[model samples]
Target: MSKAKKKKKVTPNQQTSSSKWIFWVIGIIAVCILGLIVLSNMSKGGGDERAALTYDNQPYLGKESAPVEVVEFGDYKCPACKNFTESFFPLIQKDYVDTGKVKFYFMNYAFINNDSSRAAEFAETVYKELGNDTFWKFHELLYKKQNAADEKKDVLTESYLEDTLKEVSSDADAKKVASAFKDGKGKDAFDQDMKTANDLGITGTPTIYVGGKKFEGKTIDDFDQMVKDAAKENK
Candidate 1:
């Protein structure tokens, strides 16, 4: 009294077709993985997809025709930036910047605090009003003053920056620098720097680049070696 149900059998051709489809899918997936690996390798190998070195009105040191270029994205209020300025940057300056093998440029990435932005604005004003040589001097002086003060205290006040300007450059007009700082003559330039830093995915201060590639080295010798390699490539 029990009824038995019969099952339908799949054809060999149908099974082969399904297997081919699965193989095609697996092949496509493998190709995609290989493509991703190649793109990642290209990105790691100094591809142009990363941050570009733009010299738009930024202050720099060394010869304009220098074969290699070094760019630093820094925040004035960052303690690490202070340390780099005091300890590592001088060696870079002496070895590469002063020697004219590299052109060093500074860009503002003022994200630490409001005073960081203020100090960056003041620096932009100096670069606009006082010129490159004075800007470099004030750049050093600002780091010196930052290291001399309490780290937690906001020390880069307008008056303090003005005094620092006077201390660095005797011929600089204090009132003009003050008014420029207030009226935001340097704001656009500073904003450009900020935008560049954001585009570069920079999350910290003192991010440096050599020959338009992000410098991943942790030590001074590593940086010097990078610069030397870049110089050789340029030649």
Candidate 2:
């Protein structure tokens, strides 16, 4: 073989070697990235599947297709839920939810161990009767007045519930909106919520699951690190 023939053989071999190394490096990096993400999500609940609630036509605040889920099964009459909503939700909504770092859901159940279930059911019914925004306002107001106590929680009575609906309404006859809360209109929704809660194994107010792991707390601060840790995985 002459000089050009020798060069051609060597050049082809060098190119082939370089291509093989490139593919190997790329594959390794891709796997590392994928493993990191999987590990991150699995940090919570060891990757167990959990229930997602869909009632009252509520609008979700975070990314619909998030890799992590944070579901809350709470009672409108639960004091812990009230405290979390009043104090912790602001931080959570500001941080994880508003930033689209996590997918969030709310499951309303009446478990103050009292007639509060009636209030919860009525709230759900009114949300359907009213609109999304009005329902949200009504829900918040109910929690604000609610104090889930040990002896007996003070669930806002029918009149107060009606006042809340009216206060949040836009002169649209909130009384008609409040009417949905009466009789058994809300009972069906209340039952469905309870069934879902039972299925999810929820045992308390402010029961939260991040990636299927229970977040034990009466406030949002308890799950801060978990959220950060989960985000680091996705990023």
Candidate 3:
């Protein structure tokens, strides 16, 4: 055999070129991986955004098959929330809710005070123990009382809530309602509502969402038009 050709040793420049090529390949792969990871996180974030607005399993009004969905985040002791119930809500109820164009839901954002939380828990108890119809009835009664008040008062004692429940429905066992409130039967639901409100960045009561977007309108007419627009879009 011819004397073995002296092995062609890699020169430094050639070795450096080879190393540069390998580094480039690794850099490209790393960039692709990072892009995939970023895309995955974006997808998950989008899912969470949608889930935040679903308002699933919460108390609702109108037909279950209603095309558009509306949600209200409210506090029992919030004057603005009471104003919504007294004024804006009835108009919506008469138009969209009663007409079966929208399904409306309510969640407690009881951030006012201890009484606010207590009222939320009491309402939850009414929903759980009494039923949906009675819950709505109780809800209206609570707001009505809030409206009738001369000024804001922390009157939501256990006894007061028990009395109010009895007043809302003669069929209600005041003692049982009181017992349920005391036993923390409604605390879990109230807490869940609180967590959802927190996640949604709700800092005030009477925040309304229509068709998975926050309502920014300042007038009832705007809200009405929004509902109409949302209904049309859903169809």
Which segments of candidate 3 are over 4 A away from where they belong? 1-51, 147-153
TM-score of each: 0.83, 0.65, 0.74
On residues 80-190, what C-alpha lDDT tens digit does candidate 3 reach at each position? Answer: 888899888998999889999899999899987788899999999888887788788888888888743633567888887888888878744667777898999999999
lDDT, residue 156, candidate 2: 65
Candidate 1: tens digits of C-alpha lDDT, residues 1-235: 8888888899999999999999999999999999999999986765434356688688999988889889989987888898899899889889888888899999999987788899998899889988998898998888877853555567778998888888876634866888888999889999899999998888998999988778988988888888888878778
Model 3 superposed RMSD (Cα)? 8.0
Relative to the true structure, how large is the alpha-carbon lDDT of every model? 0.85, 0.69, 0.83
Error of 3 at 204 (Å): 0.4
Worst-scoring 10-residue span by lDDT in model 2: 47-56
Residue pairs with colliding backbones in model 2 are none
Better candidate number, 1 or 3, judged by TM-score:
1
List candidate 1 segments past 4 Å from native: 1-18, 31-50, 147-153
Residue 44's lDDT in candidate 2: 51
Residue 152 CA error for candidate 1 (Å)? 4.6
